[model samples]
Target: MNTLNQGSQKYDVAYLKQTIIPGKTTKGQITQMFGAPTNEELNSTSTSNESNWTYEKTDEGLDKYMKLAHKYVSTETSLKMYETSAQLAKAQTVANDVSSVTGTKTGQSQTQGSVLTIYFVDDVVKYYRVY
Candidate 1:
């Protein structure tokens, strides 16, 4: 009998929700933890003086032509630092309380877990964890 173990590795909720953080952490530290980032950007000159990084991961699984049975998971994490140290602590707090969920399917039925982490510094979402 064929088992799911032998199936190809595909992107799924399990792989997307792995980037969540719960404490004081910086973009540099997160990069070290998850390797190179997928994208990076800085806030507008009018906005805070800080940079953001986005890390993305994707995988393909099973073939369901009925409605496209490929799994794709992407996560974008952003971290920013201000001119004052006071903002640093708040930024870290906002980056630690993020959660999200995303998925797609067609004819057949697939039960996929939807879990996302939204990092917040000072109680605001800064980074996002999506699988």
Candidate 2:
């Protein structure tokens, strides 16, 4: 399967909520449930080394139609579609502006993905955050 497609896979959020307990859950269980983390970090503290594991899922597709629409459509029309003027302006800028450094148009639509991060100290879960 294409791991690149975030919407293609299903994650058990409820199960994660029930299982991930700070100070109780171990790194092994986390690895078993979610497979290997996408990223890992080592943090140094006064006492010992701490570890952070991040599991991320992203869904990205080229928004060709939106790009085309933005290029052809008027600002007034784009404003109606966007929620705010700032958003419209940013969209237009991204779609149209050529980067002075890269010399490439920098417009693309990307939906932010969900991230699960577990912080570990002494081989046990110290804290976790989901965003």
Instruction: Provide backbone clash counts, one per model.
Output: 19, 0
Clashes of 1: 19
Q: By TM-score, how accurate is candidate 2?
A: 0.48
Weakest ten-residue segment in model 2 by summed lDDT: 105-114
Candidate 2 collision pairs: none
Q: Candidate 2 — what's its lDDT? A: 0.64
Cα deviation at 39, candidate 2, in Å, is 0.6
Candidate 2 lDDT by residue in tens digits, 31-72: 776777779988875376689998765413223344456677
Give me candidate 1's TM-score against the actual structure: 0.32
Query: Candidates' TM-scores?
Result: 0.32, 0.48
lDDT of each: 0.38, 0.64
Model 2 bad stretches (over 4 Å): 1-13, 59-113
Q: Over the full model, what C-alpha lDDT does candidate 1 score relative to the true structure?
A: 0.38
